[model samples]
Structures are given as C-alpha cells and as structure tokens.
Target: MTERYSRQERFTPIGPGGQAQLANKHVFIVGAGALGCANAEMLTRAGVGKITIIDRDYIEWSNLGRQQLYTENDAASLKTKASAAEQRLRAMNSEIKVQGIAQEFEAETAEALVDGADFLIDGTDNFQTRFVINDVAAKIKVPWVYGGCLKSYGIVLPIVPGTTPCLHCLIDHLPQEGSTCDTVGIIGPAVQMTAAYQSAECLKFLTGHSMTVEMVYADVWGREYSSINISGLLNPECPSCSRDAVFPYLKKEKGLKTAMLCGRNTVQVRPDQLSTLSLSDLSSHLENVTDRMKENAELLMFHVEDVRFVVFKDGRTLIHGTENVEEAKKLYQKYIGA
Candidate 1:
C-alpha cells in the first residue's frame, strides 16, 4: 500500500509535483453520504495531507448500498456518517490527517467550517446546505466543487469564485423538499460518476492546474454526457456571486428550522437558539427508552415507535420515517425534551 499513489503520480497530469502539492493541502468535505465518502476515499488514497469531514446524519442500512465507507455494522450500530468516514479513510491512508466533525452545516458555522481549507467539496443532498457552502466559499474566495446526483443523472461544476459562474447563477432557487430527490431515485453509478468528476476537479484546483472543462453533466445509465460552457450563465444580479457579497441564503430569515428531507422521508428541525446539549447526559436519559440507541461523540440516536430520532449536541434533530414537519417536531419535543 505504500506504493498506492505511485500510479496516480505517474499520470502526467498529476505528476510528482502535483502530488506533492496535494500532499500539503487541506480539504473540507461538507457531507459524508455517498458523494462525500467517495471523494474522501479518492483524495485520501491520492495523498491529500489533511481532510475534514462534516456531516449531520448517521449511517442507515440503506446507505450501505452506495455510501462505500460503511459496513453493515456501522449502520446496525447507528454510527455517525462523518465519524465513520473518517475512520475508514484513515484506515485506508494513515499518513493523512482525517478529522471528522459530527455537526450540521448551516449559516452560523459555515465560515468556521472552511477555515484554513485550500478547497471545498459539496456532497450535500439539499440545495439549502449547498447554498450555505457556496456563500461561505464565495465570501472566503475559496474554490469549491459542486456535485449532485439524482436518479441516473448527475451534475458536476467547479466554482472558482471570481473565475467562474457560481451555483446561484445556474440554479436560481432550490426546490421544495420531498419533491426534489425523493421522487427521482438515484442509482449507485450516478453517485460514483459525479463524485469521481468532483474529486478530479478538486485535485486539479488544489495543485494549481488549469481547469479547461466547464460544467459536466452525465446520465450514466442512459449513456449520455455533455460539457456545457456556462460562461454566459454568470448572473451579475445574483446575490451570491454579484460581487455585492450579500448572500441571501446565508441570512437568518432565509433559513427554515424545519423542513422535509429530499429522499429520506425525514424532516430535520434545528433550534434557532444554540444550546449546549450534552449527548452523554441525553444518552443516560434515553437508555431506558430503547436498547437500540447508540451514542457517538456528538450524536445520540434511538428509535421509538418505528420512528428514528437522531439528536445532535447542538439541539438539532433529524427524524426519520416521516416527512410531516409538525409530527417530527412533536417527536423531538417528546424524546429530546427540546
């Protein structure tokens, strides 16, 4: 395994120098689901010096089919995605620094999340979180790779801040939850294809190589592919990329506390006021409810009446098995004492 990166370095595009450049860089991946795990595995094997993975969700049996980094045990034990990915990546490449933070990505913590990072990679399933990543990346002038997979199709774009059109210019607004990705089921190939393209772009950008490719679109199962030149799509009136620096999505009013998840049939409710909730204490209290409960460093998860509750240290909740916002809220209040 010591010679793992040899073949990669031999590839002329990313020769020894580029490999060295990547060896000194730090990358921040915003999610640890399908795309996030794939990218992390690629970059780690490629010899990226440091990687920080931030994710809010935990592993489920369904995630094992495409997420790549987790085993059935990870899912059965209710392991946090970020932490699990970190453990897997480190096991694959111990020379690299792999740190995982089990936290939700939102406006309040977006800036700090990208701190000291050379590049950002978007693996988030929702546009709201993607927009927050874009806003934070744009504010810091950090280049970010945006990749999304839905059904058999996927989209990949490299946003270089002032160099290229941002995500806001391409998609003006995010779609409503449950109707977005849940309706159009994604395949494993689509997720891998998108993340491969995204990881390639990330390596190029990190090594100071030129990116000649514009937006990449692919329908792996359909055997369709296209390279779109989106230079004309730049919106000067765009709030996130208009140079005005007033990110509309980053604003407090622009965010919603509770919303339905795209494909998970879940609703996430985040408290506006931050709290110092202790997962350990919460674990002690929830132990009587169900023996299926699991506790990670910053997460406490359990099941009640066929409903799954994933509670965070910051007083956020991702309730699975139902998309009803009110119903999810009631469950959170009942189980989490929020």
Candidate 2:
C-alpha cells in the first residue's frame, strides 16, 4: 500500500490489515442510480479490489441532482448508467478492477451477476429487485447491505444470510405501494445518509468486523435518527432465509415482467425468456412504423408518436412517455415481438 491509503489505514479498526482485506474483496452492486453511484464511488476510492455494477436505465437530467459519477454530457448522450459509472470508477482508481453491465437485474440473471461477489449492495430503487437480491444472498450465504431513501427519509439494514433477519421477514413493514420519490420527491441528504450507513456496514463486513443486526432509519430534514433490532423479525417459516428456504424470488413466475421506472414516465417490459435480438434487423423492420429510428450495436431507439421505445439485445424494451404497463406491453408487441 502506498501513501494513498494512509489516512484510511491509520484508522484503528481498519488499519493496515483491514485495508489489505478490502483491496482483495469483490463487491457486486445492482442499480447505478443515486445509491449505487455513492456506494461504488466510496468503495472505488477506498481501493476495493473489484466491483461489478449493473443498471438498466440511462442517465437523465433529473438524475444529475442526486446521482454522482455522471454529468450533463452523459445525459445528453443518453449514456447508460452502468457504462457511465464504470468509466468514472476506472478513472478514480486504476489499481482495482471494475466491470459495469448495462442490463436489468431480474430473476433470470440475478444469480449469475452475484455469483462470485464477496459482498452485495442494494442500489436498486424498487423492492422487487431487492427481494431477488435477498433470495440470492440467503441461498448462497452472502452478506449484503440494503438501503433506501425517499422524501428526506432513509433506512438501512445490513443482512448476513443466517445471522440476521432477511428482507422477506420484514416484508409486511416495507411499503409495497405508496407515494414514491416520483410523487413525493427525494432530497440529496437522505440519499447520502443512506449510502453512508451502507458504506460503513460494508467496511465492517469486508474487514471481518462484526455487524449489528438492526435496521437504521433517518430523516435528515426532520432531524430524526433511530434504529430497530430486527433479530425478532427473523421468521422460522420465512420463505427466503428459514431452515427450509425456497428462494421464491428466483423463480421465473415471480420475476418482474413489467416495472415502472422510478420518477420517469417510463415502463420496462421484459420477455419471459431472454432472446438475442438483432438490432439491425429489428431497425429495418421498424422503419415503416417508427420515426427517427436509430440503431447501435447494443440497442435501438425509435418513436411512435409521443412514445419513445428503447429495445435492448436481451428482449427488454423501455417504453418512455408513459408508465402504463399495458400500453407499454402493447407498444412492445406492436414494434418488437420476441
């Protein structure tokens, strides 16, 4: 280690040994939005050996207010969040390895993305993805940090497979549907507070330090902070982490077929099974019905009236200008049937 990490290494808990351990650890992060950007940047600067982060969305003007590792130019260019994050991370630290994949994190691919990770981070905006992460973590016995923020409030929980209660145990308490950030609005401080707690937990876990089995809650604007012990929430009959675990979220039927992108008037539709779509061929086929059709190696973008469609290689289509799942599905079917 050089003088670069001297300040971090000087900290007693992490010292030289913990720093070394961190340098050899691999962290898998899902979602390259606000939380992911903070977590990945902190870990990258702290010299984490490797990082693999995935995101389905691209940068936007709205994201710039809270999301790091992205700029106005990135949004203008419609750079995928994953690609932008990877570029910034590599520029931050050349000593470590960083891989960014522009893809959706669903049941079919969750296991593979998290396979070799030493730790996992929840940077996703939705709970469906978190459930998948919880299932994969429980089944594989990997520890993960979960964090969420909305409207000046945030919550964090560090989950160790067997030791701590999994997310499913607290499902009843988690809001399934309510006013989201899109409706109520989110503040920057809340996002940072959540990410800070998450990063601290990660440092402790990766450095071989014991972690508390509790959920931390905070409202930065409200000036409130509290934590709850979730040890009692561990259900004996829990589907995710109980003795007879089923890993229900990993099943194809339970996977998300349609998701509304947070704060965006967009809906994403994924096929039941992934298919390799030839963008060139699809672009050619869509020329008759679509306008301003554009094709690249990875994706194709076009417009049908006011609705914008972005089709990916894995048979996933993002229907912008509307959040209606049925309408998005219809558009997908009409434009690119897989």
lDDT by residue (tens digit), candidate 1, 1-338: 55878898889988888888998999999999889989999999889999999988888898888999999999877788888898999899998899999888888888977889999999888888999988888889998999989989898998987668898888878865444567768889999999999998999888888664489899999999999888888778778977776987778753338867768989998777768898888888888888888777667778887988888788888888997888887887788765
Question: On a 0 to 100 scale, what is the lDDT of residue 59 in model 2?
Answer: 81
- Candidate 2 lDDT over residue span 92-164, tens digit each: 9999999999988888778888888999999999988999899999988999999999999999999988778
lDDT of each: 0.86, 0.89
TM-score of each: 0.90, 0.95
Clashes of each: 0, 0
Model 2 accuracy (lDDT, Cα): 0.89
What TM-score would candidate 2 get against the native?
A: 0.95
Query: Every model's Cα RMSD, please?
Result: 2.7, 1.7
Backbone steric clashes in candidate 1, count = 0
After TM-score superposition, the amount by which residue 99's alpha carbon in candidate 1 deviates from its true location, in angstroms, is 0.7
